[model samples]
Target: MGADVIERYVTDLGSRLQGSRRQVRDLLTETRDSLTDATEAHLDDGLTEAEAQERAVEEFGPVREIAHEYQAELAVAYGTRTLVWLAIVLPLMHMAWEYGRMLLIGPWQDFGTMPPAWYLFIAQANDLTSGIASGVALVALILGRILARKYDTRLLAKVGAGVAVVAVGTVLLGNISIILATAHLDAARLVQSAPMLVATLISWIVIIRFGLLARRCLSCATIVA
Candidate 1:
């Protein structure tokens, strides 16, 4: 292929991959410049421009294959950074919100009057469950980040599975605690505490959302692989 033909093929390949026009242009420009440099080097060895271009194209392999490799690398980098940000910010945000709720409205009023031993036990259990869930989630997020760096889709899927499991377990524990509190104390009072109820519901919703997002991420990994 001639230089113009090779350049057009690379440009067309870039257009086919989803992204902003600027991004696609930048990627194609980089690829084209690199190939041009290689072709120039080959030309210095006494090959004609057309022959050099052809050899460069052959060395670069198929345009689609090159584009896919570029896209996957970019995706893994973006996804890893995103996961790391979420890992750092999310747990801290959740803890802050939980503490804020406790301070603002006091403990779950419905369960406060329960036997001292029962409250102590339940509180311990709550802490234990929360700690375990958070620890597991943090580890999963970290592993996912590492796997993403390696572009190991299978490992990413495993990380997603771990996250989904922890999320489900946390949701289950939260719901059970709410039920027990409502059963032992005044249902009316619990309902009246709109902030507490809303917070709980939001927490559950977030868990469900994470589960769904993880599944989608896993599916993307599978499709890409």
Candidate 2:
């Protein structure tokens, strides 16, 4: 019965929180360990099993409240991770779609020949931009992991946010360049790429959210320091 109660509480907490799955699992495992230890201590003190279990649960406080506290911390880490992923993926997908579309329908100067010099230049530029964005995203991912693990260090958080901003900015600029360079910005293209556009909007939102949270964490760290 005590084990069942602990399982249910951890399950409920897991449903309510947002973060890395591994981290959440680790937290639950730690909670279980602490509760078990407390229960064992109570039992050693001559308490009944039921009484010990109840005391253990009470000592840990309410699951919902503790989960809320964890949510506050993990939400920022989740946002940081989400932004890093979108920064890396969205641009690459957009560039791939653009290039694929061009290969299928673009005008070629000769039969079975390569695209024009301008086309090659633009493609190279897009690839280079995407590469730089991906590099920034990698940096952001590494720094975000450090921030999440340490849950402190204002400098690391700031650097992570800065890298995320650069990555998102690069993606934005790449998208704009693709739009300007292509002749497919008509209603048909808009309808076809609507999902991608919506994803871009969501990416922007994630970037803004992560950036704000990172700044808030930095501010708090400064105050604590």
Candidate 3:
């Protein structure tokens, strides 16, 4: 009877959590072991098995409460990791796409008539914007990871989410600026930019997904354990 209660409690708790099943299980393992130990103690005190199990479960508190605590922590941890990976990856991919586009349409590559010097200047400005965006993303990533690891507060996590949102917005702004700059150049240049445009779109989607996850983390209460 005691074992059944424990199993049901854990199953219910797991059902309430938001992470992967394995992650939820791992998070609750220590809690389950502690509850079991408490139950054993109650049994040693001469309580019946069912009574001991009931007491142990009561001491552990409601399943929803425990699950919410664990879920909040998991959400913050996962948010930090996701943002860090995006910060590292998206910048590199953006740079690579830019390089590829430049190589495909460099002035010297195919120029029946060399475009205006202003066109090259605009291209350089676009590169500068990309560089600025990459730097901001790195800053956001570093700050977010530090905050997530150092503090277990919803406020800090919310701040991290804000940083991530800013980073995403900055990158999108840079991409749009580049696209606009491309319009001042030859139509062939825009065609050459298609691959980079596609890459930017994909990166935007990834960043937005993570940003939404970060918001979810922000909504959860801080875990205390």
Candidate 4:
């Protein structure tokens, strides 16, 4: 009888959450343990089994209320994961692409038809953008840990999601600008090297993957009511 009530409550609570599978499972397990403990306490006080479970569920608060609280924590966890990915992957992707170019095609100076000053400036700026975005992600991640207990979970989640989106967007913006500038100046340069083209494609795929992550992070943060 008590198991039925606990099952119903846990299922309802689980339905409202969206996040890392391990995180969600851990929270649900903890909820079950708490409810079981509460029910046992009620039973020790002489309440019937059914009465104990009902009381435990009541004490756990309304399903919606509890779910909202859990959702906030889950959102924060999701944001943290996304930030970590951004911090580590962004710089590595940038470096890998740069190194692949240097190895496969030598320096840009090796090309007979050198690109103009504006193209070089754009390339340099794009490199700097990736570094800056990675730095921002690292700072946000560190501050998130430091302020975990100091700030509201929802606020932290929103801020983290926003940072992730902006960081990804900055990297993507730099890539697009450089691509367009290169295409306009010398379209042949874009596809001259098969190896570089593959590297560029991989870079674009990484950017798109993180863009989706940022979108989902924002979605998770937004639904924390």
Q: Model 2 over residues 93-182: C-alpha lDDT tens digits?
A: 656555654665443343356645775576567667756766666766676667757765334444544565566666556556655655
lDDT of 1 by residue, 24-123 (tens): 5777888888889989999999998988988888898787787676655444433443345345544664676568567666675444664456655765
Clashing pairs in 2: none
Index of the highest-lDDT prediction: 4
Q: How accurate is candidate 3 locally (lDDT)?
A: 0.64
Instruction: Report the C-alpha lDDT of model 3 over 98-198, residue by residue, as the tens digit.
Output: 67756665544467776577766755665565456456656765675677567644434455456556655665566566567657564555555576657
Write one digit per residue (lDDT tens) for candidate 4, span 1-225: 665999899999999888878988999999999999999999999999899999999999999999899899989988888888888988999999999889987887898778889999999999998889888988988887778768676766777799989998999999999999989988887998998999999999999999988998898899883
Q: Better model by TM-score, 1 or 3?
A: 3
Clashes of each: 0, 0, 0, 0
lDDT order of candidates, best first?
4, 3, 1, 2
How many backbone clashes are present in model 4? Answer: 0
- Measured over all alpha carbons after superposition, the RMSD of each candidate to the real structure, in angstroms, is 6.0, 7.6, 4.6, 2.2
Worst 10 residues of 3 by lDDT: 216-225
Candidates sorted on TM-score, descending: 4, 3, 1, 2
In order, the Cα lDDT scores of the candidates are 0.62, 0.61, 0.64, 0.89
Query: TM-scores, in order shown?
Result: 0.54, 0.49, 0.67, 0.88
Residue 176 miss distance in model 4 (angstroms): 1.5
Judge candidate 1 at residue 224 and give its lDDT: 44
Candidate 1: worst-modelled 10 consecutive residues by lDDT: 74-83
